[model samples]
Target chain A: GAGVSQSPRYKVAKRGQDVALRCDPISGHVSLFWYQQALGQGPEFLTYFQNEAQLDKSGLPSDRFFAERPEGSVSTLKIQRTQQEDSAVYLCASSSHIDSPLHFGNGTRLTVT
Target chain B: SQKIEQNSEALNIQEGKTATLTCNYTNYSPAYLQWYRQDPGRGPVFLLLIRENEKEKRKERLKVTFDTTLKQSLFHITASQPADSATYLCALFKYGGSQGNLIFGKGTKLSVKP
Candidate 1:
């Protein structure tokens, strides 16, 4: 696909379990971002990467949430000891430039029961 | 802390009428504002962008106006149609040191009835 691609469209995890979400950004895109959207709410920023460098992770809810864009192409968001509050749609977006319009993937919906 | 607000309540309008959505912000002025449309179960798609220097920008039937002094932006859709019904999100572009992030409003759901 030409747009950003995300895997495991839906995931149901038991509380205290771990899960990892994957995102493949558009080819040659220099910027990638992760956002978490709760039901009926807008997406909240989680982290941002410029190629292989993780520039920002300020919006992450807690230390349990971590993300990495290894080799500057594919990225992964991992949650350890997931809690019920971790349930949300995780969205990934890519842009060719720092200030360009973002192209977003449909997103991965994670439910922690 | 910066805050963005959009009407949490849905906006109902008849087809063929014009639909206007408002977005307001406080605590900081942004360099630009972006509007996006999101359908059910889909990701947000970029609609229009208005810079601080430019008061208004238009593309096809979509128009966006930015008022830096007022810290508000208005999105207008002319000739509303059923297909135009969706949740519209307003984002403020905040620049800090070397990185920029978009702070988004909760979004306003627009319903165009035929």
Candidate 2:
């Protein structure tokens, strides 16, 4: 891909509904990251993967938030029992290496009603 | 706990003037800091990065300075243009944390009027 690509650019979910956001990172990107951005706020870290390994999940806010990168090229972030607080932009980023600058996707705007 | 802070207030400047944005951090010493430009409804694009040991860095009209002693960084855009109007963010890698986990400030919005 030319850059990181995310699907379902906008999502509206009801309370208690489950939603999944997908990210297709640049070809051969070695690292992937997920972030959550609230209105008027900077993106906050959610999770990270190096290749197929889930190296970090410490940033996830709660148990309802889950992310996976099975094949290491595409990733998915799933939220279960969504709440109003979950309404925000879900951002996906990828990098060639640990210290490289990240390339970001436009992100999926999730609105939990 | 590590914390990053950017001026919450918006900055307005006339075109052709230099626009400077500040970022400060507390309770952590980052090895590197990065600057990003974000437009409304879009993801942030990487702009620049300065290491703790480097006093300053420049890329065309963009200059970034890092002062580890003061835990501060300044991003300046020389000859600012209205196209530069956007929220500027500062981020750092969390020490002892995930390599890809970056701590970001809320960001400062800069508006350049022609």
Give the CAPRI rating of model 1: medium
- Candidate 2: segments with Cα more than 4 A from true spot: none
The 0-to-1 C-alpha lDDT of every candidate, in the order given, reads 0.90, 0.92
Q: Score the docking of each candidate (DockQ).
A: 0.67, 0.69
Clash-forming residue pairs, model 1: none
lDDT of 1: 0.90
lDDT of 1 by residue, B48-102 (tens): 9888899999999999988888888999999999999999999888666222478
lDDT of residue A62 for candidate 1:
98
* Candidate 2 residue lDDT tens string, A1-113: 69999999999999999999999999999999999999889999999999999998989999999999999999999999999999999999999987788899999999988
lDDT of 1 at B71: 85
lDDT by residue (tens digit), candidate 2, B1-110: 78899965589999999999999999878879999999999999999999888999999999999998899999999999999999999999754655355788999999
Question: Model 2, residue A95: displacement in angstroms?
Answer: 0.5
Model 1 interface DockQ = 0.67
TM-score, chain B, model 1, is 0.94
Q: Candidate 1 i-RMS (Å)?
A: 1.6
**Candidate 1 displacement at residue B70 in angstroms:** 1.4
